[model samples]
Target: MDNLTHSLVGAVLGQAGLKRRTGLAMPALIIGANLPDIDAACFFWLEGAEHLGFRRGITHGPPALVLLPLVLAGLLWGWDRWQAKRGTRPKDRLPVHFGWLYALGFLGALSHPLLDWLNVYGIRFFEPFSSAWSYGDTLFIIDVWLWALLGLTLWASLRSEKKGGKWRRPAWIGIAVGLAYIGANWAISAGIKASSHSPYGLQADLIPSPPPLEFWKRDVIYRDPETGRWMMIDYSPGSAIPDAVPVAQGQPCAIPDLSALRKEDGELDAFLFWSRAPFATRAQGGGIVLHDARFYDPRARDRFSIALPDTPCEEPAGE
Candidate 1:
């Protein structure tokens, strides 16, 4: 999920009454919700696809989940002490409680992974211990519908609070509606995957590829078992009809024999590690182009794909 969604979720959690738990409850909640994404800082040091392998790993994993909130709680506590010493603490501020701060931090941090899992970009829930990726395949990376719903809820709740009216009600209702929307999408994804039939008797993996505002449509990645060719199809759960043509490149691409390149090139290795459904096609320079089936788009050729122009190309193992 995008940072905006994460921040909105944090604010909603705060408005939903967690803000009453401590002096900086809202700050802790909001910041903690986005803390996991701190791993993105690797961008400065890591190059190319390396960040892909590093991101959403240790940071979103079990150890980081526990440690990050503790660190946040300590910082919040330290800030309160500093404020007290300076005699600049707000008179109306609630007493700062480390226990409640930690609790709010935990809750907020937990929300990050849950929302991240709802998208096609997978999350590593138990990294360091296990580098496995998990996906929800329920929503697009950025959902305009969610932004609108969450943004409106936050606005309405804040307005109600300022006017001395019922504020928590709106926040709670917003959370409920968000959950229902996610549940519906999850059911749809699972149902489509279940009912989808591959004429070649292969399993289809459905990825939610709805436009920013729409959620009824999706795309699928599946392999032709007989030919070992991977293909993608735009599909709608309601219609259950598979498109006759594969998306992007009309013909399916083959999985290259990556054994030699995987061992020699660190960049390609990282890309392969991060790619969930990787495929390779011959490039114009006689090199191979690597892509993840879930995100490949012909219009955006440079994105979601890496080119290895110097390496000697090998025939695809499937060939």
Candidate 2:
């Protein structure tokens, strides 16, 4: 999920009455919610595609979840003290409680992975402990509906706070509605997967490709077991029987032996590590084009594909 969603989750949590636990509770919750994404700094050193493999890893795992809050709590504690020493501490602020600050931090930090897991981009939830990636396939990386729902409710919550009304009620409502919306999306994905039947040996993956506000629709990507050809379908879940998309429509692309190429190209190596269902196609000049079925689009040309120019196949390589 995007940082805005993460921040909103934290802010909403704070609005749900967690803000009264200690001084700076809201800041702790909001900052901690986005803390794990500190790994995003890898972009400074990691080139294209490499960040895909580096992101949503170690920082999102259990250890970081436990430790990041401590770091955040310490910083917030220090900031509070610094403010007091400078005679700048607000008189109306609640008493600072290190324990509550850490607790709020942990709660906010936990929300980050939960939301990240809900997206198709995937996350290494148990990283360092395990390099395996987990995909919820429940929501798009950025769901406009989710943003609108959460944003509007949060605004209402803040408005209630300003008017000295029941602010927490609005926040609680937002949380309930948000969770319900997420649950509905999850059920949609789960139901689609449960009802889907792949031909004997072929594997089919239903990836959520909700465009802006159209969350009912999704994309299905599959490779033919017999032909090794890759294809995609724009599917609407309500259809009891989707029209069989021709799997043997075209010749499968010859993919070179990736062992040596993966070792040579850092970006390709990372992309392979991150790609859930990767396939290849013939590129211009006898090179190979690599693609992940989850994000590939014919009209976008090579937008989600990587070109390996003049690369040799290892013996009987290619599909």
Candidate 3:
């Protein structure tokens, strides 16, 4: 999930009565919600697909989940103390409770992984302990419907707060609606996968990808077991599966030879780690071009693919 979603979720949690638990509780929640993304710093040093291997790893794992919130809680606690000593603390601010701050931080930080797990990009929940990727395939990374629900509820909650009306109900309702929406999408994804049948009667894998701004629609990717070919179909909830066609380069060409490719520098290692339904082909000039079936688009090859150099110019190897 995107940072905005995480922030809104944190704000929603705050509005649901957690904000009054302590001073700076809102900050603790909001900041901790996005804290796991600290791994994004890998972009500075990791180039190309290398960042994929590191982005949703250690920081999103159990150790970091425990430690990052502690760090955030300490910083927020220290800042609150410093403000008190300087007499710059707002008179209206609630009393600072270190325990509440830590609890909020923990709640916020825990929310990050839960939301991230609801997307197709997947996450390594057990990273450092285990590198296995888990996918919810429930919602798009950027869900407009979610934004609308959270945003409207947040607005209503804030308005109610100013009027001293019942505010917690709206936030609580928003959280419930969000969870229900996610559950509906998860069921939809499962249904689509179950209904999918391989064109050639070979074993196939079904991956349901959420389209931007369209919560009810999904793009399903089907991989051919024999040739590594990918077929795409647009799916709608409660509707029949549409005809699937070859995407990007059409039928799977040939599997490129990667036997000679070096893994010491972590290029292939990273690509393989990040790719869910990976396939290989020959580059225009030479070497191997690796891609994930989910992002296979004719118009956008460079966006989700990596090129490996120094391979023999031989025909693609048989599966």
Candidate 4:
């Protein structure tokens, strides 16, 4: 999920009455919500596909979830103390409770992985302990419907707060609605998978790719196990599963020999690690390129693919 969604969830949690728990409760919740993303700094040193393997690894795992909030709580606590010593602390600020701050931080940090797991881009929940990737495949990375629900509830909650009416109700209701919406999408995805049969008569792996703005419409990626062919189909809420179009149709391509290529390098290892539906092809310069079928754009292969050396050059003819 995007940072905006995470921040909104944190803000919503605060508006749901967690803000009154401590002086820095809101900050603890909001900042801790996005804290797991600290690994984003890896982009400074890791180039290209390197980030694929490193971005959602250990920082999103159990160990970091426990420790990162402590770091955040300590920093927030120190800042609060420093402000008091300088006599710059707001008189209206609630009393600082270190325990509450820690709890809020932990709660906020926990939301990161939960929301991230709801998207197609997998997260390593057991990293350092295990390098396994988990996917919710429930919601799009950015869902407009989710934004609307959170945004409307947040606005209503703020207005209620100003009037001293019931602010917590709106946020709590929004949380319930969000959970139901997620459940509906999960059910829809499962139904589609169950109803879909492979056109090639091979065992098929179906991946639901949600589109922006429209929550009901889905584009599914289907991989044929026997032939290693990729296909795609668009799905709507009430519509039946339609025939899939081959991803390689009319595209000039060749299947590179996977056994011939060296696969020990950092780039190759990273690509393999993150790609859920990987395939190989011949580059224009006679080099080998690897691609994930989910991001397989005939016009933009280079964007989601990596080039490898032309060493074991057994170039089969274009398919």
lDDT (C-alpha) at residue 275 in model 1: 89
Return whichever of 2 and 4 wins on TM-score: 4
* Models, CA RMSD each: 2.3, 3.1, 2.4, 2.6
Model 4 scores a C-alpha lDDT of 0.80
Best by lDDT, which number?
A: 3
- Taken over the whole model, the C-alpha lDDT of each candidate is 0.81, 0.80, 0.81, 0.80
TM values, all candidates: 0.92, 0.89, 0.92, 0.91
Deviation of model 2 at 47, angstroms: 2.1
Worst 10 residues of 2 by lDDT: 310-319
Ranking by lDDT: 3, 1, 4, 2
Mind sharing the TM-score for model 3?
0.92
Can you list the residue pairs that collide in candidate 3?
none
Where in model 3 is the C-alpha error above 4 Å? Answer: 196-204, 238-240, 250-253, 256-262, 300-303, 312-319
Candidate 4: TM-score? 0.91
Compute the lDDT of residue 155 as modeled in candidate 1: 100
Span of ten consecutive residues with least summed lDDT in model 3: 196-205
Residue 191 lDDT, candidate 1, scale 0-100: 68
Candidate 4's C-alpha runs over 4 A off are 196-204, 248-264, 301-303, 309-319
lDDT, candidate 3, 151-218, per-residue tens: 99899999999999999999999999988988998888876666625233323357788888887788
Q: Quickly count the clashes in candidate 4.
A: 0
Model 3 whole-model lDDT (C-alpha atoms)? 0.81
